[model samples]
Target: MKRVVALAALAAALANSARADSATSQDLSKGYAKFSEQGGQALYANVCQACHMADGKGAAGAGRYPSLVADPKLEVSGYAVALVVNGQGAMPPVGRMMDDAQVAAVVNYVRTHFGNRFTDAVTKDDVKAARP
Candidate 1:
């Protein structure tokens, strides 16, 4: 159907965009390229914003993407870190395509933004430990 085709196209585009964004930071050991985005805001804008929405309120249609806005789950930084590193349910393990620092940056951005006010940061060591 048209919806299926459109979804497929969107997935392909996102995959391609990720690849391009991480082209310069290939991690041969992991067999995946690391995202080149350095800042938390940039990483969020380039990656997480798509599904979670620009407002971090998430979306609902074909699937249920949980809202990051003032979500209590983000209060525990480890939960967010592990989820990013390992994923859960419908969410893909996007952290696999990112380095520890990138993962930390993105997670920190999400926690600090979207009306969520968890001040404690997710360090690179936290992300490294969270990785499978």
Candidate 2:
């Protein structure tokens, strides 16, 4: 009886440990996916190029379009979703970019691919939190 109890306890402990590990793995995967840079690039080309132009190089004359790619602030601790959703200076607010998930995807794309080494990917929650 004593041996049986000990074996049962050991099995239960192992099962609990495996469950905890599975949960941890899932959490990590979700966290990593939030920063998919390719998705961010797609968002940029489709939505941002009209103003900023290709390669994130803003127009010279009138300079109406602000540079979107390869920004110094790309390496900043916070996600750029706030500024993307909210207009700054002459940039207009995001109306079509209202889709939070799409915005995060695009932001991650730009931040990762545009000559910037930043690996951080924005999440839908991040965009939602900073939404105006």
Candidate 3:
């Protein structure tokens, strides 16, 4: 009788542990769903990293990707947003590939990081407005 009780208690404990594990797994899944990079680093990795390089310094040559750092054109956030959304000259409208939030992130990222130090952040609303 004592052995039976011990086995039952062990079984119940295992069941409770399984339930706890399942709950923790569900919470982790929810956390992943909510995750996003507001800093734009992730979006840049997926989109701009190839052409712009990780440094944001850009490249020059046959198809010159202009430097995002210390560029006079980026003085206005609107100009950068417009260029990203609409494309200009040699660059394609790569900004169209991203939604408003992603666009805002990358624009804000470029404006603030690298050698550029423009303080104003590009909002998702600004990205939406730039869309054509």
Q: Candidate 1 or 3, higher lDDT?
A: 1
Better of 2 and 3 by TM-score: 3
Model 1 quality (TM-score): 0.74
Q: Model 3: runs farther than 4 Å from truth?
A: 1-39
Better of 1 and 2 by lDDT: 1
lDDT (Cα, tens digit) per residue for candidate 1, span 1-132? 999999999988997876776566662222246555677898888778879989998989977888999999889999999988888997888898888998999999999888989999989999998888
Residue runs of model 2 more than 4 Å from their true location after superposition: 1-38, 77-79
lDDT of 2: 0.64
**Which tens-of-lDDT digit does each residue in 1-132 have in candidate 2?**
999999999988996786578675652222222322235555576567767767876676755565656688877624477667776777766523347787777677667765766777667888778776
- Weakest ten-residue segment in model 1 by summed lDDT: 27-36
Residues 1-132 of candidate 3 have per-residue lDDT tens digits of: 999999999988996776578676653212222223334888777567778888778898877786777777787999989988899886778776667888888888887777778988988999898899
All models: lDDT?
A: 0.85, 0.64, 0.76
Q: Give the higher-lDDT candidate: 2 or 3.
A: 3
Can you give the lDDT of residue 114 in candidate 1?
Answer: 87
